[model samples]
Target chain A: MRAVALGDQTTYDAGTLTVSSAEAAALVADPALAEVRVSWASPGDSTRIVKVLDAVEPRTKGPGGGGIFPGFVGPAMPQGRGTTHVLRGTAVVTAGFLPRAQEAVVDMSGPAAPLSPLGTTHNLVVEFAPAPGAAWEAVYEALRNGSLALAARLAEAALGATPDAVEELPGLPDAGDRSLPRVAAITNLQTQGTFKEIFVYGRSFGSIALPTLIDPGDLDDGAVVSGQLGHPSLKNPTWVFQNHPVVAALRARHGVDLLCAGVVLSPEPVDATNKELVSAHAARLCKAAGFDAVIVTKEGGGNADADMALKMDALEELGIPTVALYAEMAGADGTGPSIVVPPTKATAMVSTGNYDERLSLPAMERALGGDRVDVAAATALDAFELPAAVVYASLSPLGWGHLTCQEAS
Target chain B: MTTRVVHYINQFFAGLGGEDTATVPPASKAGAAGPGRKLAQLLGDDFEIVATVWCGDDHAAGPEVMDDLLALVRAAGPDVVVTGPAFTSGRYGLACARVAAAAAAEGIAAVACMHPDNPGIDEAGTAPVVASGEVARQMGPSLETLAAAVRKVAAGEPLGADDGRVGKIPRRNVTVDRTSAERAVALVLARLGGDREATEVPLPRFDQVTPAQPVTDVTTALVALVTEGALVPDANPDSLESARATRWLRYSLDGRDVLPAGEFRSVHGGFSTVWANEDPHRIVPLDAARQLEAEGAIGKLHGEYLVTAGNGTSVGNARRFGVEWAADLRRQGVQAALLTAT
Candidate 1:
């Protein structure tokens, strides 16, 4: 994977692509959308973006391959084996007001500026307004389509530019050094049906029959796309899947201290019966893969916690050691138990801090996406105290960020 | 500018006789008394023992005496309050803990010293505490420990492991050098190599509740509606938080036949509330429950519904809310409840 800068230019200049707001609007024009507005937010700028839908990295597959975000932007074809051009330090952010959407705020400059990937990146935000009386399903489809289209277009500018740096991702082999621990990564994606489903190769994960195995390389090439309306702090989004930290860590240590087995995608079913079935199936696959240990992460909370608990029980019961990564719901004052479902066997875990810890966001000079803050109460986006739950990927269980919980007296 | 320190002790420590003075009321001295002299010496000229408040162990345990002792300590306007080196005396330990806890509640920095297993330690509130030996012979070392803790507390420094304090403290949010992902990997490797302490979050003990007996006859049972779905009026008149809610609210349903779609909506932030907004009954089920009431399936329906946002709610807060809700239900003579959790 090679990355280049998105330099400002009407066309591809140096490594950057400069497109006016008009040009950006033209690229993602859809009948379902009433209006499309383009804006820019760079690090250290006094900008706050509310109602954030999802953030996507700009990447494109080189000749003779499917485009970025396979299944959504292009054909759901096999990827992970060819040259891919990525736009580093850049993101295509989709923002809008959805009736049931969870709040996701990105502060360009504040105490929370460095807590989220969206805050650090040079984001090109696409704000969409639904056509009057438009069906929510159609509006959501338009949002996804428009965001992916913009991301693909930005990555296309990186083509023919001098490569800045390239990362050679490690491949999963059948077996490795027996002396080293063999480990795999299993994550549950939000599968609460339409509008809250995570798409794998352009398909809803909820529709998948069983736990599925996919290459780490495919995950980087956009095999997973987030359409979840769950808590913003926990949802993977598209960019998180594209730059999965757990997978990166495992792959980075492959052959050194451990062997990276493979990545498994599990569904976070809402019901107890399906949750049990899915967790059992996921553990079965891990056992069949002959993994010595596994690193687990989950999407959202509540039901996801149950799914994680079931998986841990199943895996531990089979004599497989596992480490689960998750965020605690320790309330605002931080005087509460963090975990919801107490693990019966899998005791090893990593906490991504307290998602319910409130953070006071400084008043921004500029607010984008909407005028009012997206919360249960009515308030302006200029300034407010909100829980980390509303911050984009701040408490992601995948552990991409630095927020953590510590015991104190 | 020295830090003003207020020291508190029991009747015996004040040299006022042992069991005979057990009922003596709280009294105050202008300067260092008992262990305060040692604390003052150890804390040096940087900290001054502005006042010393002493009380009978038995009297201090009473609420009225606690208020009087707290008044004396507050009047001193000390920078920080230090209590005990109570050793193993149960009554003295309790008195010290209560005084420190009271002072701390008024936004004053406070620290208490006692044996680690002292029963009174439970009342120490959020103030930092130093641990002493089990008997009075360890007074010298105990005062030394309390003196150091006093310095730190006065200087606004956090008490750490080396401070000789009891553990099981509160959990705070902090940013670490490594991401959770990196930590998870490192922990997994450690555990695989036979390290049992690799778990970052130890599994907490959960509470198990005995089931309530089913009502013998629903025709005479008083049914009530309870939900964690965060259902509230459209205006959110009470302003219930969307997530991590600390309070639960009750709304009257005396005359309403159904929870209209636009009139009532879910304020929960965990799951998508779209369906609930389109039809509020999906979460609260007030409509169906009302229908059941009309069909004589139950003797009577409770006139009010209780609600709170369950999203990201801490277990402790959840338990607190449940206890209060249950108490209210019991007081209102509600026999059976249908709770809807999202």
Candidate 2:
């Protein structure tokens, strides 16, 4: 896979990634919208930015009309294969007051910098001002789509230039060494109900859903996108969807330690019977696929921990050694029980980190300005004290991050 | 300034007559006495043994023991409480654990050492207990462990995981910094290599509480409805958040037959509240409870309902809510409660 790894102070026309305040105002200049604002942001900015809805990396499918994140932004197409051009690092971040309950903030510098990529990467910030009459659903759609369109436009600059790197992920072997352990990963998506959601191949999941297989290739090509915005410290961002860490981690040791049998795109069911039904089917899939072991990961929030615990129990009962991964929502102090319904069976559990730990961040020198800044009202304190739950700036817990431990002292 | 310490021990360790003197009552001494001298010597210049409290095992286990001991320790005003390195003596071990618990309740740093097989080990709860051997011969090493535990607890140093130079009872609910993916890989590799790594989340130990006796006659019993389903007044007067609720709303239902559709709604973020919002009774069920009251299936309905969003609600907050509300219901003479979950 070829991707253009862009750097800090990354450029569009030999200058910094640029967009006019006037052009930004007009781009979101819907009659329904009160106002819109945009600006270019570089790493180590003086101030912080808040109310981030989503961030999209600029790229035009390695040199074709078919864009990244097909179905939502462009026409549907199979990803992972072929040359996809890249303007890798920098992204267009959407800032807005979402129609639903909450959103996230990204600190560009200070002690909070290490928590999110938003701290390191240069950003083109687009802040939205919702009008009195503007519908929330319309606002959500406009900000998301607007970010993608900006990404494609930026990719036009890197079209004729050569890519910085090429990554190779070989397809599964028709026949592998008999001793290799077949491993399947179950991405436990939190699409069971309500506001938070995840999209698999452009379709939103809810209710009694079954597991679907996702190719490693498709995963690298934006097969999964997170629609859920709450619980930001641990949520998977669109960038992680394009370059999945689990897929990358597994593919690294694919041939030697274990064979990447396949990925199971599993959605959590809200009720008990549905959870049982779906998990039981997943156990069957493990057996039919001849998987020697499986890794289970969950998208953050709710009682999805129960869904993961039930799924692990099912697989373990089948004599399959399973690994369960999640960000522990153990509340703000880390003294509470780590999970809602913990598994009784002897299963290997991995915590991504506590979503509730607090941090005190120093004020930044510059702020990536936004319109109608009610995001300020979101916090009551003047000091930058926040829970670990708010810093998805790095898209951790669900992706590449520290391995948190729950030490009983 | 020196850290003041109070050491507690039993009659035998106090150099009082053994077994025959077991019925003697408790006594408070001015400074390091008997084994307290050894612990005080080991604790170094930073810690000064201000008082030593000794008692017969039977006397310390009696009803007034904890109060008497607390009063003695309060006057001594010690920075830390070091109870017996109670070896194999079950009665002494139990006494020491109890004294340590009392000290902890008074917000004093405390440590208790006992043999693993002693009955006190399990009952010590979150009190740091240094594992001691079953014989008095182990007192030297046991005191060293006890001193270290006291110092660590006093200094507030993290003691679980590989920081094992000082080990305490495992509290599996504390979270540290590590991502789940890395943990998964390590665990997977360990499994494949036929090895075991400690789980990030140890299998949770659940407490089993006895259920309350059921109300034999609903026609005469007063019933109240409580829910973590996040039912709130239309305006959300308390402004309880959609998730991670720390506060609950108590809505008055004294004269109401039904919760009007727009007057009540599910403010929860976890599930679709459309159906619950369409008919508020689907969650809190005021209409149904009223119907039961009218039909004489229940005596009287509590005039108010309590609600909070349970999704990702912290165990601490939930516990506080349960305790505070249970008292409120009991004060109102409610005989039974119906808890609804979303």
Candidate 3:
């Protein structure tokens, strides 16, 4: 937990992080939130978010199991090792009324906001309302405890904070370099729930039945989390399941180039008897965690790619060697048929792009939440026609980014 | 700007009058009219034919003469069109794969040649096509694989089977940017030292359908109740979207039998809607289908159900929603559909 890149008027002792309007109406005091609006945004702002209900990255629960989002609330701890600060150049997002009908947009600046990774940090923009007869499971538990009580009151200004930058990633201590290469990973979530869910510590990983495993120190802080209301650019929120860039690039290249061996998670089956009961117990927990090579990923891109091609054909029918990645709607002129069930021994694969390729942004002097652009106020004036999935928090089902490939156009 | 190709031969490679003008009709002329002057002399100085067209394998075998040779090769705008090495004339190789699939549905970047048992090589869809060689001494290696696939479709690229010397036309694999953990650690160091790779998704053909013809005795069937899972009501009053949905909702079990939870829910985000939003028939079951239609074992049901959230949907939009929900349940007569999915 380090994430410290705060600048442009952000403060964690390093000064300045206000939000006015009676402190955003007393920071989500939850009467199941009758109204809330917050706002902050930084890093090249012409502002232009819309309906995007989730975009986290504000982290702050210092010291192990401090539980900010571990399994979604209160006590379910088990995060990967100790301490956590990460306001890593900020982000909160949330966006107008939403308990489920998903969102992710992030254009903060123009030219497609540097292709959105929440347009390079520093953002807050919440906007909420629910209470006039609440109950959408209490408006999704008051927008998930009012967006984790506003990222723990802006991580209470990083109290005595330290981090300025640090991302080591640990996890090895043992396998004592048996010539590296054990590498594991699985993932394929989207427990198929009311909102393509996943939450694990705070419960509801579709009431789990098997393929679980996950212990890279309970993903180092948030024992797994996400609203990931599928397809808003291939959803995996909860700050990309607590910063999972392939599990922090396998804990920053674990025992060196391989020996990582940590995740499995699974779920995403939905028939063929729960895809042979979770790809044969995740290919027998990747050969009882001995693993020679695995890496799966995938979450929401039609038929969860037949549950990651049934755990890459049950780990290549046992000869091990797998690797999947996944995504791809590929239609909308990307020439359709990107993939649906696959796994006839999934030969390598990566993809993560073309979830209907389309985008047309330009105008924006600022507009978040209740976004107005009913089209034509622009065309002759500024130009708007946006929303064609090029990062409404999308298509990166964790294979991070960069996709081009229409055979490299 | 040089590239305007458009060739498409026939009528004895446009010298006309073969088999009594093979039934005449379709036409077009200006520029490279015969064998398109050897594909504009092997596309030297980069492609210029401009127009050739010629019809008549018995007048392009009907469909009103293939819409008059696709309106004279789409009025020859041509950035690439090409059409015929049609060698083993199975009706001029299915009329040069239907004028290179009607100049690729009008976006125009066709290719087509012929012979791989030419029934127009399975009606040339991804458009590439080349193979040629059952007659006329393989017309100079099928016009040099149609001048290197019309120079990779005039530089816009995307002709498939990845350059195995251009015999392509299978396409739809596309998704290759490396990092399936760097191809699973280079396929586990080439399969733990044995070797053999290539699997980037090539194993799905599932698409089955055949079911119908069952309800013979379900108490005089009419059945109905479908789902892609987005149940409805409960404020979803057509708000729908529970995941790449593409609108389907239908609701109304009219005089109802169950599904009540503050009046229905589960707008499907794939699953776990609190046991179908607290027993909304655990997924539109309509109370075990009205308790098997009050034990008559079933006979009525069809009171508007349908739905549609198959999560990230799209297996070609779930086969165009099973061909528009089997043509709107065969125009609402239904007969049987139970269908339910999480």
In model 1 chain A, the worst 10-residue window by lDDT is A1-10
Model 3, residue B207: displacement in angstroms?
A: 34
Query: Against the native chain B, what TM-score does each candidate's chain B reach?
Result: 0.55, 0.54, 0.24
Strongest candidate by TM-score: 1
Per-candidate iRMSD:
2.3, 4.7, 11.9
Q: What does the lDDT read for residue A152 in candidate 2?
A: 65
What does each candidate score in C-alpha RMSD? 7.8, 8.4, 24.8
Tens digit of per-residue lDDT, candidate 3, span B88-186: 565676667667766787778887877655444444545667666778676887787778778888898766554322332233323355533444445
Candidate with better TM-score, 1 vs 3: 1
Model 2 Cα displacement at B100 (Å)?
A: 9.7
lDDT of 1 at A317: 87
Deviation of model 1 at B244, angstroms = 2.5
Quote the positional error of residue B328 for candidate 1 in Å.
Answer: 1.9
lDDT for residue A63 in candidate 1, whole number 0-100: 50
Worst 10 residues of 2 chain B by lDDT: B161-170
The reply for model 1, stretches above 4 Å from the true place, is A1-10, A175-179, A374-381, B1-105, B108-168, B212-221, B256-262, B272-282, B285-299
**Candidate 2: regions farther than 4 A off:** A1-16, A19-34, A175-179, A365-381, A393-395, A406-409, B1-107, B110-180, B196-198, B234-239, B247-251, B255-258, B261-266, B274-279
Docking class of 3: incorrect
